[model samples]
Target: MQIRDLPYPDPGVPDARSGPRFLLWLGRNQLGGQLRSLAWGLLHFGSIAGLPYMVGVAVEAVLDRSGGRLALAGALIVLLGIAIALGDTMLHRTAVTNWITAAARVQQLLARKTAALGSALTRRVAAGEVVAVSTGDVEKIGWFVEALSRFAAAALTVVLVCVGLLVYQPALGVIVALGIPVLALAVLPLLPRATRRADHQREKAGRATELASDTVAGLRVLRGIGGEELFLDRYRTASQEVRTAAVRSARMWAVISAIQVLMPGLLLIAVVWQGVHLAREGRVTVGELVTVYSAIMILNYPLRHFEEIAMAYSFSRPSAKRAARVLSLQRTAESTVSRSRDGSERGEAMAPVMAQPPADDSLPPTGDLYDPATGLLAPAGRLTAVVCGDPDEAGRLAERLGGHPAFDDAVDMPSVRLGDIPLDDLPLAIARTAVLVQDKDPVLLSGTLRELLDVPASGAVNPEEALDAAQCSDVLDALTQASAGDDPMTAHLTERGRSLSGGQRQRLALARSLVTDPEALVLDEPTSAVDSHTEARIADGIRHLREGRTTVVLTSSPLLLDRAERVVFLADGEVAAVGAHRELVHTEPRYRAVVTRETDAERVVDRDTDFLTELDIEETA
Candidate 1:
C-alpha cells in the first residue's frame, strides 16, 4: 500500500501465536507490497551481479586487442550504470514503502486494541510496554519485514554469481564456492549469545522507559510529596542499567561484524592466490584471473546481507512477542459471556434497591448501570451516590461503569454489565452512548476550550448549559482574569490543563462530560478539589442538570450525598448499607465514620452549637 493510503480503516486482528509466527503473518498480509519490493530488489541486485561479468569480458577484449569488442564492452558498461541507478532508486522507494506500511498496520492494530480494551489495557500491559510496542517495536518489526525481500535478492545474486564462476573456471570456482558457505555459517554459533544480550538490553530499556513514563505522569504529585528527587535518582539508576546492557549487547554485535569482515577478506585472498597458481600452470588466462578476482570481490557485497538479515530477525523476534502479549489480553468477560450474565448470584448484587423516574423537563437517560462485582445498581432517571472508603476502588468502579470492566484472575468476580448487555461484547459506539465516567483526575487534553468540550456530534447539551451545570463560572472568571479579551470557549489550555488550578480542571472536565449527555454518568469525587460552598452549589447544579439522567456520584462529601436520592455505602468493596444520606449516617456506624470523619474538636463545636440552639428555643418560649 502507498503512504497516502496508510492508516487502514480496519487493521485486521493480528495473529498472536508466537513472535516468529506473527512476523510471518505480517509478511503474508502485505504480499503485494513485498512482491513489489522483491521485484525492485531483484533489479538492483541483478545489476550488481552482472557487473563482474561485464568487467571480465572487457578485460578479455582489451587483452585480445579487439577495438570493436572493447567498444561493445564500453556500451554495455554504460547501460549497466543506467540500470544500476534506476534499480537503486526504485528499490529504495519500494523497501521504504514496505517498511512504512508494515509499521502503520501494526500501529493501527495496537490503537484499535487499545480503544477496545480501554482502561483494562494498561492493567494487562505496562503503559511503557504499550508505548514501546507502538513506537520502537513497530519499527523493528517493519525493518525485519522489509529486509526479507532484500535478503532473498542477495541470496539469489550470490548463487547466480557462483554458478557463472563455476562454468567459466571450475578450479578457482571450487575454492570460492566452499569459502562462501564457511563465511555465511561462521557467525551462527555466536548469534545465540548476541541475541541473548540484545534481549537483555531490550528488557532493561523497556523497564527504564516505563519508569520514565510513570515518573513524568506523576511529576505533579511527586513534587507535592517532596519525592521528585527520589524518583529522579530511581530513573537515573534504571537508565544506567539500560545503558550498560546496551553496551554489552553492542559489543557482541561488534565482534560479529568484525568476524564478517575477516572471513570475507581471507576468502578473497584465497581466491586470488589460487587464481594466480592456475595462471602459472597455463590453466587460466590473465583475463580469467582478473574475472575470478572481481567476481569474488563482488560476492562479498551480497555476503554482508546474510549478517544483516540475522541481526534484523534477532531484534524483531522479541518485539513481535511483546506485541503479541499485548494483543492477546482478553478483557475478562467483555469478549465472551459476561460475568454478570453467567447465571450467578453476583448478578443479583447489581439489582437496584429502588427505581424512580426522573422529575424534570429533560428526557430520561437510557439504560441501567449495574456493577455486578459490588452489587451497586444505578437505576434509570435517578441520581445515586456511592460512598467508598477506598479511593482506588472508587476509581476502578467508575471505570467499570463506563464499560471498561476490571480484568482480574479471580473466578468469583462478577462481570460489569450495562443495560443487560455484556460490556466486552458491545460495540464502542453503543458503550459510549450508554455511559460517561468522569475520573477523580480526568485528563484535559491540549486544545481550545470549545474543542475540549466538543463530544462527537451531539446537540443535546450546549456549551453554556454544560458549563453552568458544572459550576464553571469561577473557571471562566479565572481564565478571563489570566488573559483579558479572550473568549473562555476559545482560550487554549496547556497539556493536562496544567495552566488551570486543580478545581478549575475538574470543573472543565465535568463540563466536557456533561456535553456528551450520555444515558448514564459516573462522576468519581467530582468536586473534591473545590471548597465546601462551591461543592454545595456544584452538587445542586449536578442534580438539576442531570435531573432526568442516570447519574452515579462516588463521593464521601455530605453535601453531594445529601443531594443524591439514594446513597450506597461500600465497605470492603461490597454494599454495606443503602439508604438516604441522613438515615445511613444515623443507623450505620461504619458509614458515618467514612462519610463524616469528624475529629474531637469538630464534635465539641457541634455540641456547643446544639446547646446554643436549645437556649435560643427556651428564650423564644
Candidate 2:
C-alpha cells in the first residue's frame, strides 16, 4: 500500500504472541515500505563504494596519459554522485513513512482495544502506563521497524564491497575482512546491562507520570487537605530516581559506542599503514594503494549501522512487550463485542464468531431484568427504587444489571437476564441498547453542546427535549454565554466539563443519557451532586421522561424514593424488604435506620424544635 493510502481500513488482527513475535508481525505487514527503503539504501551505499573504484581508474588513466579513459572515468564518477544524492533522499523519505504508518497502525489497534474494554482497561492497567505505551513506546517500536531496512542495506553493501576488494587485491582483502567482523561483534557483552538500565528508567518514569495524573485529577481535594506539597515532594523523588537511572543507562551505551568507534579506527589505521608500506616496496601501484585506503575510510560509515541496529532493537524490544501486554487483555465474553462491530474484519470477509447468527438477530430481548443473586426483579414498564445499606453494594448492582461487574468477572457470577434471555447470551451492543447504566460519576465528552448530547438512540428524544427534562436551562445559558452568544446547541465544552460545576456536569451527563432513551435505564445516585430541591425536580423529570419504560434508580434520598412505584430495601446485598417507600419506613426499622440515619439524640432535638415553634405560634395568637 502507498503512504497516502494509510491509516489502513483495518490495522489487522495483531499477533500478540510475544515481544519479538509482535515486532515480526509489524515488519511483515509493512514489507512493501521496508523493501522500497532497502532498495534505495542499496543504491546510495553502492554509489559510495563505487566512488573509490572510479577514483582509482581516473588515477591510472592520468598516469598512462590515456586522455579518453580519464574522461570516461570522470563522467562515470559524476553519474554515481547524482545517484548517491537521489538514493539517500528517497531512502530517508520512505523510511519516515514506514515509521509513521507503523505507529499509526499500532495506535488504531490500541484504540479499538480500549473502546472494547472501557473502564475495565484502567482497572487492569495503569492510566499512566497506557499513556506511556501510546506515546514513547509507540515511537520506539516504530523506530526499530524503520531501522531494519537501513541496517540490511548497509550490511549487504559491506559484503558486496568486500567481495569486490577480494577480487582486486587478496593481501589487503584478508586483513579488512578479519577486522570488520571484530568491529561488528565486539560490543555484544554490554547490551544486557544497557537494556536493564533502560527498563529501570522507564519504570521510574511511568510511576511518576501516574502519580502526577492522580494528583491533577484530585487537585481540588488535595488543595483542601493541604497535601499538594506532599505529592510534589514525592514526584521530585521519583524524578530524581529516573534521572539517575537514565544516566547509568547512558554510561553503559557510551562504553559500547566507544568500542564501536575504537575498533573501526584501529582497522583504518592498520589498512593505511599496510597500503603505504606496499606502495613503498613497489608491491602495488599508486592508484591501487589510493583505492584501498579510501575503501577503508568509506567502510567506516556503513559500520555504524551495526551499532544503530543494536541500539534501536534494545530500546524497542521492551516497548513492544508492553504494547503486547496491553493488547493481550481480553474482554470477558459477556462484555466482548464481535470484531465486525467495529469494521475491523470487514475487509477480510471473515466468518462470524458463532458461525451462525445469534438468536433474535442480535436484537435486545424484551422483558423485565432479573438478578437472581440479589433476588431483585425490576418489573417491566415501571420505576423501581433500590435502597442499599452500603453505597458500594449499590454501585456494583448498577454495573451488574447492565452485564458489567465493577470489580469482578460478570461471566463467573449469575448472569442477569432480560425476558428469559441471559444478557451474556446477547452481543454487547444489543445488551447495551437493552439496558443503559448511569453510575454515580458519569463523564461528559468535549464537543459542541449539540454534539455532546448527540448519541445513538431510539430517536424519540432530541437534544433540546432531553436538556429540558434534565432541567439544564441554566447549563445551556452558561454554555451559550461562554461561547459569546452563539447558539446554545453550538456552545462548546471542555473535557469532562471541567469549567462547569459538579451539579451542572451531572445534569449535562444525565441529559446525554436521556437522549439515548434506552429500553431499560439504570441510575446510581445520579442526583447526589445537586441540592434537595433540584434533586426533587430531577427525580420528577425522570419519572415523567421514563414513563412506560423500565427505570431503576438506586438511591436512598426521600425525594427520589418517595416517587418510586416500587422500593426494594437491600441489606447485606439482598432484598430485606419490598414495599412502598413510606410503608417500609414505618414497618421496617432497619430500612428506616439505613435511610434516615437519625440517632436518638437527633430525634429528640427535632421534637424540641417542633414544640418551641408551636408555643411561639400560640403566643402570637
Candidate 3:
C-alpha cells in the first residue's frame, strides 16, 4: 500500500493470536510495500559491495602500469558514485514510505477498535495503555516492519562478499568465512538478558505513564481535595522506578554493543594477519591481499545489522502483543444488539463483531424498553423517572437500557424482549434508533455548538428546539461570552467542554441528545449539576417537549421527579415501588429517605419556628 492510500480501504482483520503472528500478518498484508523497500535496499547495498571490487582492480592496474586499465577504473568509480547517490536517495524514500504506511495501518485498526468499543475500551484496557499503544507502540511496530527489508538486503550482501573472498583466494577465504559466523553469533548469548531488561523497563514505563495520565485527568479534583502533592509524590516514585529500569536495560545493551564491536574488530585483525601470511608465501597477490582486507572491513557494515534487527525485534515484540490484545477485544454480546433474533449471523461475522455493520434489511423491534434485571419498564409514550438509593445502580440501569452490558451479571443472563425479540437479540439499529441513553457524566465533543448538536441521527429535530427544551440558554450565553463570534451556535468548545462549567456541559450534552429525537430517551441525572431553579425549568421543558414520547430519567431530584408522569422507585436493585412522585414519597419511607436528603439544620429551623409561633399565640391570649 502506498503511503497516500493509508488507512487502507480495509485494514482487514488482524491475526491477533500472538505478537509474532500479528507482525507476520502485517508483513503479509503489505507485501507490495515491503518488496518495494527491499528492491531499493538491494540497490543501495549492492553499490557498497561493488566499491571494494573496483578498488582491487584499480590497485592491479596501477601495479601493471596499464594506462588503459587505470582509465577504465576511473570511469567505473564515477558510475559507482552515481549509483551510490541514486540508490541511497531512493532507498531512504521507500523505507520512510514503508514506515508511514505500516504505522498508518496500525493507527486505522486502533481507531476503528476504539470507536467500536467506546467507553468500554477504557474499562477493558487502561486509558494510558490505549494511548501508548496507538502512539509510541505503533511507531515501534512500523519501525521493525520497515527494517526487515533492509536487514534482508544486508544479510544477502554478507553472503555475496564471503563468496567473492572464497573465489579470489582459498586460504584467506576460509579464514574470512569461518570468522564471519563467529561475529554474527557472538552477541546471541547476551540477547535474552537484554530482552528481559527491556521488558522490565517497558512495564515500569507503562505504569508511570498510566499514573501521569490519571493525575492530569483528575488534577482539578486532586486540587479540590488537597491531595495534589500526594499524587505528585506517587508519580515521582513511579517515574524513578521507570528510570531505574531503563538504566539497567541500557547497561545490558551497552555490553551487547561492546561485544558487537569487539568481535568484528577481532575478525578484521584475523583477515589482515592471514592475508599477509598468504602474500609472503606467494600464494596470494598483493592486490588480492588488499581485496581480502577491504572485503573484511566491508563485512562490518552488514554485521552491524545483526544487532539492529535484534533490537528492533525485541522492542516491537512486546508492542505488537499489546496492540494485538487491544485489537482482539470484542464487545460482549450483552453490550450490543445481537445479529438476529433467531441467533443467525447478520453480517460477515467478524471476530470483533461491532466492526461490521448490521444488515440493511434489519429493523428495530417495536415496544417500550424493559430491563429484566431491575423490572423497570419505560412505557411507550410517557415521561418516567427512576429513583434509587444507590446512584451507581441507577447508572447501570441507564446503561442497560441503552444496550451496554451489565457490570455484575453474566452476559448470558436471561432478558425480556419486545415483539418476540429479546433485548439481547434486538438489532443494533434498535439501540441506535429506538432509544438514546445519556449518561450522568455526558461528554460534549469538541466542536462548534452547532456541530456538537448535529451528530448523525435517524430523526430530524431542530437544534434550537432541543436546546431550549434542555434549558440551555445559560450554556449558549457562556459560549457567547467565551467566543468572538456573535452566534452562540458558532462558538467553539474546548475538548470535552473544558471551557464550560459542569452544569453547562451537562446542559449541552442533554441538548445534543434531545436533538436526536429517538423513540425513547434514557437520561441518568441529566440535571444533577444544575441548581434547583434551573432544574425545575428543565423538568418542565422536558415534559412539554417529550409530550408523547417515551422518556426515562433516572434521578432522585424532587424538582425532576415531581414532573414525571410516573416514578419507579428502586431498592436493592429491584423495582420496590411504582407510582407518581408525590404518591411514592408519602407511601415509601425508603424512597423518601433517598430523595429527601435535606440538611438537619433546615429541618431544625422549621421546628423552632413552629414553637415560637405557638408561644406568641399563648402570650397574646
TM-score list, all predictions: 0.91, 0.88, 0.88
Alpha-carbon deviation at 133 in model 2, angstroms: 1.2
TM-score of 3: 0.88
Backbone clash pairs for candidate 1 read: 334-424, 349-375
Whole-model lDDT, candidate 3?
0.80
Instruction: Determine which window of 10 residues in candidate 3 has minimal summed lDDT.
Output: 344-353
State the displacement of the C-alpha of residue 599, model 1, in Å, after optimal TM-score superposition: 8.0
| Among all candidates shown, the one with the greatest TM-score | 1
Model 3 misplacement above 4 A: 334-365, 406-410, 414-430, 597-621
Compute the lDDT for candidate 1. Answer: 0.82
**What is candidate 2's lDDT per residue for 505-578, written digit by digit as tens?**
99999998899999889988888898998889898998998898888999989889999998988887666778
Q: Scored by Cα lDDT, where does model 2 land?
A: 0.84
State the C-alpha lDDT per candidate. Answer: 0.82, 0.84, 0.80
Q: Total clashing residue pairs per candidate?
A: 2, 0, 0
Off by more than 4 A, model 2: 333-362, 372-375, 569-577, 586-590, 598-621
Ranking of models by lDDT: 2, 1, 3
Question: What are the per-residue Cα lDDT tens digits for candidate 1 across 1-621?
Answer: 799988787778789989988899899998988888778777878888777777878898988998888888788888888888988898788888889989998988888788777777888789999999999999999999989988888888888878888888899888887888898899999999989998998899899999999999989899999999999999999999999999998999999999999998898888888878889999998888888888877777888889999999999999999998887776555233334332322234446443243343143324577777777777778999999877788877887777666676324555556555545455576666667788788999998788898776257888899899888997887777666746877777889999999998999999998888888889999999999988998899889988888899999999999999988888777677788999988787777878899666776787799799999999999
Candidate 3 lDDT by residue in tens digits, 354-437: 112334535555555566556666666789999987888886677677766553443543454442345456556565676678
Q: Residue 49 of candidate 2: its Cα lDDT?
A: 94
